[model samples]
Target: MFMQNLPSEVLINEVSTRDGFQSEAVFVPTDKKIEMIDRLSLLGLNKIEVTSFVSPKAIPNLRDAEEVMNRITRNPKVTYVALVPNEKGAERALATKADEVNLVMSVSESHNLSNMRMTCAQSLAQFRRICGLMEGSDVRINASLATSFGCPFEGIIAPERVIDVIDQYLEIGIQSISIADTTGMASPRQVYELCSLVRRIYPSVDVTLHLHNTRGMGLTNALAGLSAGINQLDASLGGIGGCPYAPGATGNICTEDLVHMLESIGLNTNVDLMKLLEISRELPAMLEHETSGQVAKAGLRTETRPLSQNVIDLKNRNEKH
Candidate 1:
């Protein structure tokens, strides 16, 4: 039986424009990037993380961040956000007039050291600094806790650790925060427990789940998150994202596939599954990697139609039966 009386609507934030391309060895042209995001915005997605404001030296692929942000026709319905690593990055994001800035820090000490070259405390310090920088601007801040479920370096992060990180961000005054399975190490049970705890601890804060499909548990965890009362989800079109620091970590949950599941279950995401599939088809050629999304490979259930009698007879005759 379908789960009934659940929240009817969900908010899916598309992140392909930034997270999907950042790990690629090849650079996706700025024009193509702009085109992709523009198409996605029209697919009824209300939030799209467009680019990052890190030093060009750190992420050369997104060095054209400003141009991409300015060139794309901003949609009033969609909020365009940028990832900012530190105070300087937040400053850059503000300059681009980003609707919101997402800041992240790793929960594992080892992953934190390897990825950001900073300790957990130091990373939170950076987040504090970023909050200070955005003192009086229209730009909103979202604190994302990377590897909140399990880290590559440190397996199975404690729930207390996750709550502590959330508390720190909340104390710093970020009303909206995202918990990311950065390395795709989350399980369904983890999603249920963590999301439940998050809701209990900070009932008012807007909590979004950023799930990765690296371990093949993306959809299951998403269900668990929903069971735990999460309405906001982060996904990438074509499932094209990878963690730069976590080896063998694949892309995120595909946007089209996620929408398909939600719609089938009588839940609403306000996204067009067909249009999202069209966008997914463009990823392989653009990124030079075949996507792992099932929807991209096998079209939606209704997309398939039975063959005509004539065609079936022709096929039978060709078989020499």
Candidate 2:
């Protein structure tokens, strides 16, 4: 299906700080990261991936994770999550009192080694250690399976490969799982089948879709995921972020654009579109380069504009739906 009768409310987890910044060449000041997170907190965001607890050597841009976490004013309603690679990183995240710890591993062995410098089996071994560290803790644990749809090195990934990792995640007591289209190669049919299959078997688990717009189908794929009963979605502000190791990887689905699409379709995202647009507008000046977001460049549907025949036709068609 091209469109879906979307849920009344959907959870959008902002990952700009964590995933978005890791690829930048310039180091964004800790104050700036805190400022953005604090502002996002007040905007009624469901969750925000604050920072990654990785080594400064891995992603030097986010070296100040501790300072960013400490500087941001915590909002109880908003979940503050941090990415951790292993037990050591999880320990640091726990020290900062992060509300959640997000672990990542690619489903493809080649992609895993390329991006994470570890084989898939080795990555899982490390994840098991991290899981042991989080045992008997209040901190929420989530696993984001990267390259779930397709990999640059490996052409197509089997859904069974993703399901095996998800089963392992569940065994470790991780309830939330994000299947990311690491290189933006997912088709709508592939999205539908994967989400439907995951939900059909793992009825109790919370599945989220983390998609990218590298191929310009992020919103379309998101609609397909929702059509299959996956309500949680991950997006990056200003469409920033790509894997430094994954070949041909690019920024994630733009957060404001996704929200605009959902809101236009009468789904409740609970995000302030005007405020998000304002944020997207400032990013280009802040980053010293044009961002990948298009909504700010193009006015939203509700904006003041002369309606054309094409616009009228679309409106009439949607009304009939």
lDDT values, one for every candidate = 0.87, 0.88
Q: Looking at model 2, which ten-residue stretch has the lowest summed lDDT?
A: 242-251
For model 2, how does the per-residue alpha-carbon lDDT over 252-280 read when each residue is reduced to its tens digit?
99899899889988889889989988988
Candidate 1, residues 35-77: lDDT per residue as tens digits? Answer: 9888887889979999998888998999999999988988899
Q: Measured by C-alpha RMSD in angstroms, how accurate is candidate 1?
A: 3.0
Error of 2 at 138 (Å): 1.4
Best by TM-score: 1
Task: Give the root-mean-square deviation of each candidate in angstroms.
Answer: 3.0, 5.6
Extract clashing residue pairs from model 1.
none
lDDT of 2: 0.88
